[model samples]
Target: MTGSTGDFAGRRIVITGGARGLGAAFVTALAEAGARVCFGDVLHDAGAALAQQLAVQGHDVGYLPLDLARPESVSAFVEAASQRMGGIDGLVNNAAITNSGGRLAGELPVQTWDAVLDVNVRGTWLMCVAAQRWLRESGRGAIVNIASDTALWGAPRLLAYVASKGAVIAMTHSLAREFGAEDITVNAIAPGLTEVEATAYVPGDRHAYYLEGRALRRPQTPADVTGPVLFLLSGAARFVTGQLLPVNGGFVMN
Candidate 1:
């Protein structure tokens, strides 16, 4: 896609986990692309501040507090965001938690497993279900679920996180089939190890591995994943659904 695509102009989009990291980038990029965007996150202060900053630039952006682990909040967030946006057209499921990485499956506590599944898998599903009505009303709705390349390559010591992402990919396929009749496209974007605030604790050697091992031989950034996401949300990808697009610089080819 070029800089001139009008796919986002006058559109309304809702993003989760938009307070920081990759989600923050999505809020900025989509709003700048001419979409009236409302983002939700657990970080009330940061999310509000981002919305304020974007509004100062005359961008149509709003923020709300959302807790993905709480199932009831999904429908509530969508209803509120749609009211703020006057309607809804797209959803980006980016909220997730890994809860202190680097633990074997046996060492990982039950709470860790539950929390990961509740937020990463169940949360994404509920959000989609809640937003489907608004999306159907919009007549050209789309969804982009953020997944991880770790699920594809079976990265070690992240059992819960990887499993949750794999579930997301599977749900994408099934949901795409269900929503196809409504012409609402559902897709997943699996990104590699990206340089973001959420990844600050990653070991230096791990970062080095990603940079050297990928075909691009460089680190992936928040911006690096935006183009593919925007394309999926755009009119250009209207016919593209139930597919997983990897934006990891050729790191996990399937």
Candidate 2:
């Protein structure tokens, strides 16, 4: 847990869907490490509360209302974050949407697919595009995209969510090559069955299936994934790009 001389000190970081779940964990960890974090989320009440709580702790954390379903909102949030934090050095594309209910593909509505794709894929892409310009200008920047292990192993009954995460994995690789020459390492973390508020929608059997394969036989927390995220966004992972590191508890060993 010993960070390198506050490696993120004076750095500006932007995280999407950072009000709760794993996204909030990243914000807290980075802010504690001395990074000025500007986060956006659709959950206004939670976002505002988290920001106020962190500010009380003397952390430079700012929250903005953002709806990832709209590309314009994503762009505007990034723009405002860049302006607010001075400049962008890192971005954590963690915003996503799951189906309202545990509906399988055969019974899932097209709207469910559209909703998931809009936020997980399109929103992530737009955020990266908006942040890319500033990251390039900074000359030292990194990106850590949040993907899911379900995408890699294929989760049943959650087709839309899995598909969107699969798209995120593909996007991360493509962007890594596009921004490699600029010295910006683009990578992803594919967490497996992490215990977060977001997983409340996951079916009980599905969760059991995920746990059965873990060597550790324990549920993963946001803290388990935060280390890999910070590593990717730190100087330590400069040479590591176009890689998807799994933060699962040995659930899906690839």
TM agreement with the true structure for every prediction: 0.97, 0.96
Summarize candidate 2's per-residue lDDT along 164-194 as a digit string, tens digits: 9999999999999999988888999999888
Runs in model 2 deviating more than 4 A are 1-6
Residue-by-residue lDDT tens digits, candidate 1, 1-254: 33334668889999999999999999999999999999999999999999999999999899988999997788789999999988888999999998737898889999989999999999999999999999999988899999999999998888999999999999999999999999999999999999999999888988887788799988899999888888889988888999999888888887
**Which 10 consecutive residues of model 2 have the lowest summed lDDT?**
1-10
Model 1's lDDT to the true fold?
A: 0.92
Model 1 misplaced regions, further than 4 Å: 1-4
lDDT of each: 0.92, 0.89
| Predicted structure 1, TM vs. truth | 0.97
- For candidate 2, what's the RMSD? 2.0
